[model samples]
Each structure stands twice: as C-alpha cells, then as structure tokens.
Target: MAHIGPAYGSLAANQAKISAKRDPALDQEVQTWIETIIGEKFPNGSYEDALKDGVILCKLMNKLQPNSIPKYATSGGSFKLRENIALFQTAARAYGLEDAELFQSVDLFEKRNIPQVTQCLFALGRHAQRHHFNGPILGPKMSEANMREFTEEQLNAAKNALPLLNEGMNKGANQSGQNFGLTRHI
Candidate 1:
C-alpha cells in the first residue's frame, strides 16, 4: 500500500506560504489567543459556538480593525440601523459581495457559513481602513480616489490576512468538527 503523506498537505502548504509573508510571532500570538478563546468559550465547541458568541467574534474583528464592533454597536435607534444597512449595502456592492451576504442579521450565526462571514467582515475591515471609513458598519461608500490611495503592500496584506483569519475561525470550529470553507465570496 502506498503511504499517503499528510492528507491535508495543501492546507499546510497554504499556511506556510502565508506565514512566510507575515510575522511569525504575530501569527503565533493571534493563534494562541484564538485557541485560548476557543478553550474558554467552547470546551466541546462547534462552529455554532464561535458564531453565537458575538463578544468573541467582535474581539477578533477589533483585532483586525480597531473599534469596528463598537462603532457598529453604538449606532443605535431604528433610523441608524437603517442607515447602517444602506451603508453596508453600498460597501458590499463596492466589494463585489452580494447584498444578501451582508452580516446584518444575528440569525446569521445559525448558518453553517461562519467562515465565509468571518472573511467578509475581515475584507470589509481592511477596506474600511484603506478608505478611512468610520461608520458603524465596516462598509462605507468608496470612491475611486480612496481605492487609489491603498498601497500595494496594504492590498497584499489584506489578501494575506484572509487565510490567517480563516485559520483562526477553523481553530474555533475544529472543536465541532467543522473545517473552514475556502470559497472566496469577496
């Protein structure tokens, strides 16, 4: 019988490539925090564990883009919620994500697509940083001038960060036997 070496070599290879482009220390630190959060929050956790824990998800989002969750939370009142909906819709359109894909409903936590949601939020946060968007939602109407201001390094960093974000989500989901999906929604 042929020995199959590492059934998931592709995942390992992708992780290694991403690690090469980023600071290993930072990666380790973030991974460690994610693991700790999972251990504390979901000892026998499932994908739903991470999804349902808004605090944990917000913490991760804050690390990706400071104050993002708080900004979203502070936008109180029905009118503000509607405004945020429009803002996110515009931003999602700019990011080429479907309007339905917006992380609007808490019921989204019930979906099996937490990894996709995590990636979307991560991308939106990166876009917000590049555009100096300070809205409650990570999405803000983008202009060509704003897009032009993003450096190649910044763009590449965002691209590279996706896998890391996915890996963190995978770590949490692992307790529940759910692997992060690789489908690129953005």
Candidate 2:
C-alpha cells in the first residue's frame, strides 16, 4: 500500500486550519479599534462634515506629494496650455464646480484622502468583506504573495474604529440623497 497525505480539502481539516488561525477575541479587538477611531474623528457623527474638510485635507496631501496632480500650467505660454486651461474652465463652469473643487477631487482620488480616518476605515472594511475576511489580511499568501498583515495592536485599533466607520458610511449614503436601494437592502 502507498502512503497518502491528509486530505486538506476535507471539512474537518479546513475547520482545524481555520481554528488554528482565527482569533475571535483579536477580531473583536480590531473591530473595537475601528469604532474608536471613527468616534474620535466624528464626535457629532457626520460624514458629510468630514467631506467638507476634504479641500483643506487635499491641499495638505498635495504638499506632501508635490506635483502629483495634473496642473493647467497657468503660467505656460504654449497654445496647448491655454487651450487646456480654457477647456478646464469651461468644464468647471458647466459642472457648477470651482476649479479648486475639481483639483481637490483629483487630489483626493490620487491620495485616497486618508486623513479622513473614518472614510479610510470604511473603505478597508468594505474591501475586507469583499474578500471574505473579518478584517484586512496582512501576510504573504501563496496566491497573494504581497499581501500584508496588520500587527495585533493595529488590528485591535481597527476593530475599535469600526463603529465610526459604519456611522460615516451610513451618513454618506443618506447624504447622497439618491435612492440606490441601500435602505431596503441594509
């Protein structure tokens, strides 16, 4: 008879593997961290208010990463530069947004506006849920070689921050004022 390895695909085996790795207490701690961060950032519980701070936050991000945004070349003498600026002005006028708002949004997109801790946590939670994890996975995997795992303390902090994240996400959804059917689903 030939010897065979244990069946890694069996339910019992999988359960044992998961049990060895999963730490429910640590999971709860991480959730607590997430909630705490959110509460501290938004004592009054308003994500819209946080978004209103984005312009200043984006400016700070720009300072940290200079020239990360595409500029209209205001001082350039080239015809193409003038054309681009005129086009940008026309688009801004059409959208009823100031040029600064447009630039700020671009900066926010590039930098992810991480200074808004609640929003950042919400995004991380969403991403983790999408990937079927209680929290973001940080470590090397055979499938995802570059995946990074958070330290135990970091995970606990994120857990404590979850409530604020949930509040911010919910507030943002409601503030959008567009019926995306989230109310019915949630």
Candidate 3:
C-alpha cells in the first residue's frame, strides 16, 4: 500500500546524506576489486556504467560461487538486463549478505544511489573474504573464531572466584550518588 504519510520532508536530506557518502577513491577500489575477482576489465566506461547492465555482477557471482547465476544476458532488452541484475541480487543474498548490505537492483540499473551501489560491492567483497572465496582477498581478512572449552572444575573455580573479585571491586569504590566532572553552566 502506498503510504500517504511518507517522510517527504526528509527525502532531500536523505538524498544529500547518501550523496555525501560517495567517495571517488572507494569507487576505484571497488572497481578494482570487481575486476580482480572477475579477472576482466571493463570495456570502456565508468564503473557505474560498466555495472549498470549487471552482466559483470552476474559473472562475478558465478565466479565466486560456480553457477550462481546459471544464465545471464550478455546484451538484450531492458527486461533482460533487469533480470540479470535480479539474478545477481538473488545470488548475493544466497551467498550470505544481509539484506541491509545488498543494494536495490534499481540503484545500479537506474543509476540512482551509486554510492549505495559501491557500498554494496564493498560489503560483498568483505563477505566474500569472510566466506573464503578462494580468490584474491577483497577487504580485510575476517577474524577466525576462537573457541575455548572449559572443564567443569575450571568453570566452578571461576564461578567461586567471582565473589572474591566483587568484594575487592566493592571495597570502597562507588558512583551511586556522586556527580563526576564539572557540570556545564548556562
């Protein structure tokens, strides 16, 4: 249902916020990441223009996870192009990107919110690194899980030590009713 109470007043402000987030350096970095992952350079266009048709992105998904997008349009009508974008989006979701991390298809297809498009790419790159995509690293390496198993005796000893720790912590320190630092004066 179309909402009559949509926040129209803040639309421009939100647009400005998104626009401010655009960084040419990040665009270049993301472009490099995509090109490296897909192992192909754009024919002749800006990063946004190169990815607008979604062919590159679909290829990227397939490269990361074989057959992610079984078939994508190399060139065709608008509907075909949009389908390519949609397939990429679906593959991204299936590949483990949170909804917030994925950009809307229209963002790239219509060239709106190119910053978000770049943001989505960076997120994907980071996630791919986390998932160990077996390609050149994209973003920072993901930290590995460190799990420590404690014996029952160790757990019991730690539990019994808590009271001793709390006693020392509560010996004489407190801020229950004390004001810290100078209060601001009007």
Q: For candidate 1, lDDT tens digit of each residue in 94-137?
A: 54556555665333333324444454554554455565644333
Candidates' C-alpha lDDT:
0.47, 0.39, 0.83
What tens digits encode model 2's per-residue C-alpha lDDT throughout 1-186?
A: 134345456756754654465444543443454444333333253332333333322322223233423444333444434344344334433423334334333222222232333333233333334445543332232134478988999998887875755666566456665776556644
Better of 1 and 3 by lDDT: 3
Task: List TM-score per model, in order.
Answer: 0.29, 0.18, 0.78
Q: Indicate the worst ten consecutive residues by lDDT in candidate 2.
A: 105-114
Error of 3 at 130 (Å): 4.0
Whole-model alpha-carbon lDDT for candidate 2: 0.39
Q: Which 10 successive residues of model 1 have the least lDDT summed?
A: 105-114
Model with the higher TM-score, candidate 1 or 2: 1
Which sections of candidate 3 miss by over 4 Å? 1-9, 163-186
TM match of model 1 to true structure: 0.29
lDDT of each residue in 139-170, candidate 3, tens digit only: 56656799999999999988767566566766
